[model samples]
Target chain A: MPTSDDKPTPNTDEPVTGAEADKAAEIAAAKAKAAEEVPPKNPWEEKPVAPTHSDAMDDDDVVALEGLVVSADLFTGAVTATVDAEKILDVCRFLKEERGYAFLVDLTAIDWPEREEGRFDLIYWLHRHEDSKRVRLRAILGEDQTIESVESIWGAANWMEREVYDLFGVIFENHPGLERILTWEGFNGHPLRKDFPVEGIDTGAAIYPDVYPPGGGPIVPEEGEGA
Target chain B: MMNGPERPLFDVEEMEISFGPQHPATHGVLRLQMKLDGERIVEAKPIIGYLHRGTEKLFETMTFPACIPHTDRLDYVNAAHNNQGFCITMEKLLGISIPPRAAYLRMILAELQRLASHLVWLATHAVDIGAITPFFYTFRERDEILDLFEEYCGARLTLNTMKIGGLPFELPQGWLDRCAKFVDAFPAHIDEYETLLTTNRIWKRRTIGVGVISPEDAINMGLTGPPLRGSGVEWDIRKVFPYDRYDEVEFDVPIGTNCDTYDRYLVRIEEMRQSIRILRQCLEKLPEGPIMAKAPKVLRSPEGMVYGSVESPKGELGYFIVATEKGTTPYRCRVRPPSFVNLQALPQMVKGSLVADMMAVIGTLDIVLGEIDR
Candidate 1:
C-alpha cells in the first residue's frame, strides 16, 4: 500500500473545483424551482375568513317584496329578510307560489326580552330545491304578538309552529290544533324563555308521590335527626 | 242475502286508543292518539315530549365545547353525526377550519357512525316488522362498530369524540390498520344482511307499498335522508352542500323510483354500500398533516347566527347557533332534528292503513323519540 503523503490529493485551499461548483449551482437552481412550484396549502393551513353580513337590498326576491321586507341581510351565502309581521302570510304565499320555496326547513324563535323593537324574533328557514338555495324570513313579535301560520303554505310548518308556540309561548294565529308539544298541557311557564331557571322548576307531576316529596326528591335526613 | 240476526248484527263504532308511551313498536315514548274505524286507522296523532330533556335550553348554559356531549344525547344511536353537526355550526360561527387529517378522521368516524345508526334502524325496524332474525344479524355488525368506537374513544353509544378546532388525540398505534380491516370486511357483512332480508318474500310483502308518500308530499312534509331519497328526490345535503371533505369523496346518492316503505328500505341498504365506497376513497387519499389547527385556548365566537347542517343517517341534522360577540356560550342553540320533522308526517303516512301496517310505517319513518322530544 502507498503511504498517506504519497497519494495524489486535490487542493484543500479552494472551496470547490470547477466540476463540483457546477453540480452545486445546479442543485441550488433545482431547489429554487421546486420551492416556486410547491403545492398550495390545505384548507386547514389557511386562515379562515369569516363571512360578513352584507345588505341584500338588490336581491331579486327581496326587491320583489317592495315594502314587506323591513331589512334583508345576506350572511354566509344565506339570505335573511326581516319581513313585516302583519304581511307574513302574504310574503310566504309569494315565496311559495312565485319563488318556488316549497320546503319549510325550520321554524323557531329567539327571545330577546330587552329589545325595544320586539321581544321575540321568529325565524323561518325555507329551501328551494331548484337551486338548493335557502332563505330565512325573520319577523319580530312583541310579548303577546301573534303571527300568521304558514301551515297551509307548507304542511311541514304545522308541527314546527306548534313547537315554537309551546316552547316560547308565541301564538300562531291560524295554526290548527296548536297545543303544547314538548310539555304537558297544564305545565306552567315556558321552559325556553330567559326567565326560566336552568335547574328546572317543580312540574308537580311526580311518578311516586309517596316515596319522593313533590318539588323535591327523597329528603336527606339532618346530621343529628337520623341514626 | 241471508238474514242472520235482527236489529244490527254487530255494533261498529269508531274507537280512540293510545298506541304507546311504553310500547316497543313506537321506538321510544311516542304516544299516538289514534282514531280507528274497525281494523283500519282513521287518523293518527303523534303526542310527543315524554322524552324531552330541554336539550336546547341546556345548551344555553354551557360553554361551546362543553355542549358537544349534550348533542350526543339528542340522537343517542347517531351521536357522531350530532357531534359533527354541532361542531360544524360552531366552526362556521368561529371561522375555524380543521386540519386535513382531522377532516379525514371526522369523515371516517361519521361514516362509521352512519353504518352504526343504520344498523340500529335496520335491527329495530326488522324486529318491529316481525323479522327477528335480521335484528340478530345486524346487531352483530353494530357491535363491531361500537367496538371500534370504544377503541377510538372510551365510550360507545354517546361518543363525544369531536372537538371544535380538531380531534382530541391522534390515531393510536395500529388504529388505521384495524379500521381498514373492518372496512374491508364490512361489505361482505352487508351482503349477508341483504341475503337475509332484501329478497325474502315476507320482507317484500311487509314493506312494499305499505307506507307510500308521493315525492311532492314528501318534500312538502320536509322528509329527508332515506325518506326523501325513497321518494325519488335526488336531494342529499352531502351532494348539495359538501362539508368536511365530502366533495372530494366519490359516491352516488341512491334514489328510489317508487316512494314506499320498500323503496326506503332499499335506499338505506344501498346507502350503506355508498358509505363503504366513501370510506375506501378517504383511506386512499388521506393526507398527512397536523391534526389540530392553531386555535386560541379559549374560543370566542363572533356575534351573529349561523345555520350549518350535516347529512346524518337519519336526515339533514342541522344546528342553528346564535352567538354574541366574544361569548363563550351560545345565545340560542336550536337543533333542527330530522326525526322530529320526519315524525310529523306519521299521520299522513299511516292514514287508511291497517293497524298492523302502522308498525311498518313507523319503522319505515325511523323516528327516534330521543331526537323528536329533544
Candidate 2:
C-alpha cells in the first residue's frame, strides 16, 4: 500500500497535504510556545574500510605452492597470476593447501575480438575465506581453443565451462562433457560471442522434446546417455 | 552388467528428466537438459536465452545517456545497482569526477539494491525448496526497498535515474533518512529469515551435503560474487577493487565452506547483513555537495575503452564501453553479467543431486534469468 513518488513518508521525500498542511499551520502557530525536536545524527554514517587491492602482495598471496606463478599483469600490475591450466590442479591444491584464498570468487570469459590468435580471455577472481584480498588472472586462448578443465579442481567449473562454451565458444579440454548451455535446441549461434548475431536465430528456436546432436542443445536429460 | 559401469545400451540404468525451458525453479525461462539416474542427476547442461533481448546490440544504437534504463532490464531485480554500474563506467571514460555527495548517494542506493537483491535470493531460494513462507516475508522487506526506489526515481523496475554526467537529478529530499531506518531494522529481519531456515532440520537435510562445489573448482571456473564466496572465496569487488564510496565504507565479506547448495544460502544471508553495515556507514558520513558533476550538455566520449564493474548483489556486474572520438553513440557495449558466469556453476552442482535438489541448488546460486540470458 506504499504510495507513489509524489507522496512522501516521514523519512523520505515529505509532502504537504490537506490535513498535514492544517496541522503544520497549527504547529507553526504554536512554535513560540513549543520546544523543537532535534533528531540524532544518522547512524548509516559509518564508512567502509578501505579494501586491499590485488597487487598488494599481502600474506594471502605469499603461499608456498608447488607451481604458483607469483606474477602480475604487464599493464595494470594489479592482477596476480598463481597458476595456469597445466598446473591448474596443483596450483589450486597449493592455494587451498598453503594460503587461505579459500573462496573461488568467479570464473568467466572476456572476448577481445581484435586479437586474431588470442581471441578470448578467461578471467578468475580468487578470494581468501579468512579475509578479502582478491587475486585476478587472465588466461588468453585462441579460436577453437581449449583450456584444461578444472572440474576436477573445483566442482563449480563443470558449469562455468559450459557457460564459456555457450557464450564465447571457448572449449575446456578435459571438461567431463561440454555442450551448449543457456541456448535452446537448434539455436543458430552463441549469443555472447562478439561475432554472434545479437538478434539471434533465423527459426523458431527450441522444441519441447528437441533432441540435439553432440555439441548442440536439447541434450538428453536421461542418465547413462552421456557420461 | 558387469563392473564395467554400463557403457551404451544399459536399459537397467538411470532415468531421464528435463527441468525447464519455462519451469518454475529455473528462474525466468532457463531450461536444463539434465540427465538423471533415477532421482540422482547424472549430467546437467543448462540451455538459456529463452528470454534474450539482445541488450548489447541495442546499446550500439542508443545515445550515450539513453542506455542506462536499458541496462536495468538485464538483471531486472537489481535495477538500481545495474544503473549505478553503467553510470560509473561512463564517468570514468569521460574522466569526470563525481561529487562526494553523488558517490555517497550512489553507494546508498547500491547498498539498498543489494538488500533488495538478497531478499529475492532468499524468497526464490526458499520457494524453490518448498519453503513458501520465507518468500512472503522476504518480499515484504523487498517491497519497502522498492518503495524507496519509487520515491527517489519515479520508475520502479526500469529506473533511468543515471545520466552520463551524474544522476539524472538530485537525491530526493529525506530519502536517506528513510533508507537509514530500513537498513537499521534490516539486520534483525535477516536474523528472522535465518531462524526460519538456517537451523531448520528440513532445510539442512535438503541443502547440507547436496550439490557441493569444492573450493578449487570454484576458482578455476571463474565464479564471482557470493556463489564463489560460498566455496570459501573472499573476493568481493567492493573490498578488493574498491569502487565509488565502497572504499570508504567498512563491512565484512562473508565466506563459506564445503561449497554446498546450503553454504551458498548461508553466505547470501550473511552478505545481506554486511550490506546493511555498509549502508549505515554511508548514511552517517554522506558528504553534503552537488549530486552531479558538470559536463557538456551532450556527451561524446573520447575514443577509448574502460571496464566498470560494481560488486552487485548477484555478483560482479560490469560494463565495458568502447567510445569513439565522436561520442554520441558507443562503438560497443558489453555487459559482464554476474548471473551469466554464476549460472555456469549450476551443471556441476546439480550433476549428482535429485531434480528436486537441482531446483534448490539453482535457488541457492541466486541467479536472475534476465541477467543470465542477456
In model 2 chain A, which range of ten residues has the least summed lDDT?
A: A43-52
Count steric clashes of candidate 2: 41
TM-score of each: 0.91, 0.70
DockQ of every candidate structure: 0.51, 0.12
Output candidate 2 Cα RMSD.
14.7
| Residue A6 lDDT in candidate 2 | 62
Q: Which stretches of candidate 1 lie over 4 Å from their true place?
A: A1-43, A46-48, A215-227, B3-9
The residue-by-residue lDDT of candidate 2 on B260-334, one tens digit each, is: 877888888888888788788888998886676776767867654456788888888878676767668876677
Which is the leading candidate under lDDT? 1
What would you estimate as the lDDT of candidate 2? 0.73
Q: Residue B167, candidate 2: how far off, in angstroms?
A: 1.3
